[model samples]
Target: MRMKDKVCVVTGGSSGIGEAIARLFAKEGGQVAVVDVDEANGQRVVDAIRSQGSEAILVRADVADEAEASQALLGVTQHFGKVDVLVNNAGVSAVGDVAACTPTDWDRVMRVNVRGVYLMSHFAVPIMRQQGSGTIINMSSTIAVIGLQARAAYAASKGAVLALTRAMAADHSHENIRVAAILPGTVYTPFVEGYLKRHYADDMEGAVETLKRRQLNQELMTPEDVAYAALYLASDEARFALGTALIIDGGVSAAKVF
Candidate 1:
């Protein structure tokens, strides 16, 4: 058990990559807190973990809200005593170029993807500092480093996350707090499925194939893949991996597909 007796908090843990991370952490012996705004799905994940005879709890929170973020962390502490790992996995996306994006839409993206990370970390860090050790794994994207069509706001938010991760690592390393970000490529999550259905209504299959081809391996990255990377970053095994942008993008960033 890599995380035996540790307490881990995973935001947006109701579905997709977040749920995968919560489950994996529990299986590895962490007392997991599945935090999300969806009560039904969050409880479902918690129930599943308990059914498997592992420890887990559900925390309902809107990560972009500072008050809610603080309360969520408080809930975790009240139940599990302290936080050993914090995974900021909650995020929302926007589809538009800079000119096409309205100010409101841009703010929404920043609130969830960038501000959410800050809120979670701001509250969780004090607890970690008190304990003299902690780990933070942020969910970034391949688009943060590479240009992607119709994702200007998303790219900006995730790029901020990468910078935030490094800045936090530098600020807190002396206190034994490790901070890092995971850059995943196009993953096959419910969100992606819906996105494909909406944007590629007439040619969903073709669009999916086009996306797959963009990856050198020609396959969509799974939620589990990113979850496993989160697990490594949260565990003692990745003690030396602080401030790193760990890329799991199937070589997309390295290859030129033109």
Candidate 2:
């Protein structure tokens, strides 16, 4: 019951890490807002949460769009009365080195991964300030700190999120609006699966193995693993954890085996 009665908005909640966070938050007694552009999948998540006797609503909107981002926050607040937690988890990825990454690819990644966080926090922060308390969790990545080949655009976007998290925390921690970022290593989400299919189609298993090798544990991280980290940050227990970049990367960024 760590999140009991908390009103949490999880962007990208239709699937993968975002969906995992939404369900886990509900299970812990939080009222959940599942925000995503995929209306069908988002609704499915909401319905399933309700079936389990938990509170949830689906807000269909693309996080990258200003109008939609603003409306998504409005819809959540209207239904829940206040937003206790905002999880900026909606993001897109691009695969390429700087030269290989087209301007179009770079902009698309920035829109969802960086601007999305900015827009959501821009809207959520005022509401939290008004309420006198809230937690904001931005989804960064281990790639923000460590080097990863062919992830130039994604790395840039996540690094921006980490920087933004620190800046937001400096601006708001005193007001009781805690802002933090989670740096998770390659979680086996649908997004990652799609990446494997697209880039490593001939040897999907080998690709997954390669991903696992990057982590110290040699096992792929799951969405639930990262969701639990978000749960910790969103809960009152993490009140002292302002401006934290809670790394849940299975030692990927911490050590290397030679």
Candidate 3:
């Protein structure tokens, strides 16, 4: 087992990529702390993990809130003794270019995607430093590196994530704490489904097909694909992989459409 006996905290673990990471961590023999605002879905994830005879607990809290984020970390530490890995996966997306985007939309997206990551890490880092070893994986996106239309705020937030990941890695590497980010292109998560419903309701199936063809590999990535990458970075095998942006975009970022 790659993560045998390890304790991991995954924010937004109720569903989507976060849920996939939590389940995969449990399957790999790690004790999981599933953190999210959705109490029902969070409990469902915990139940599913327990049904598989794995250890998991739900911590319902908004990751963007400093007090709640701190409490979530405290709960995990109290229950697990130490946090071996912290996955900052909770995030929200905003549509529209800068001119088209509302200030409210930008702030809301940044709150969850940027501030949430900061709060979770701010609380987790001290514990990791005291323990002398830890891994922090921030969920970034390829849109951070490439120009994606109608996602100005989202791109900005993820770009901040990538930058923050590097900063954390530089600050903590001396203490055996590794910080990294995973840049996944387009995965077919509920978030994407919701986006399609909102923006392409008239031709949902056609929109999905268009997205599939946009990928250089001609296939969409599964959440598990990103989960597997997180698993690797969180393991001892990736101890030397500090400050790395592990790209899992199925060659989308590498190709030039124009």
Writing each residue's lDDT as its tens digit, candidate 3 over 1-258 gives 999999999999999999999999999999999999999999999999999999999999999999999999999999989999999999999889999999999999999999999999999999999999899999999988999999999999999999999999999999999999999999999999999999899999899999889888778789999999999999999978999999999889887674
Give me candidate 2's TM-score against the actual structure: 0.98
**Model-by-model lDDT, in order?**
0.94, 0.95, 0.95
Candidate 2 lDDT by residue in tens digits, 52-144: 999999998989899999999999888999999999999999999999999999999999999999999999999999999999999999899
Please give the lDDT score for candidate 1. 0.94
- Per residue, candidate 1 scores C-alpha lDDT tens digits across 58-104 of 99999999899999999999999999999999998989999999999
lDDT score, residue 89, model 2? Answer: 96
Clashing pairs in 1: none
10 residues in a row with least lDDT, candidate 3: 249-258
TM-score of 3: 0.98
**What shift in Å separates residue 34 of candidate 1 from its native position after superposition?**
0.9
RMSD of 3: 0.9
Cα error of candidate 2 at position 88, Å: 0.2
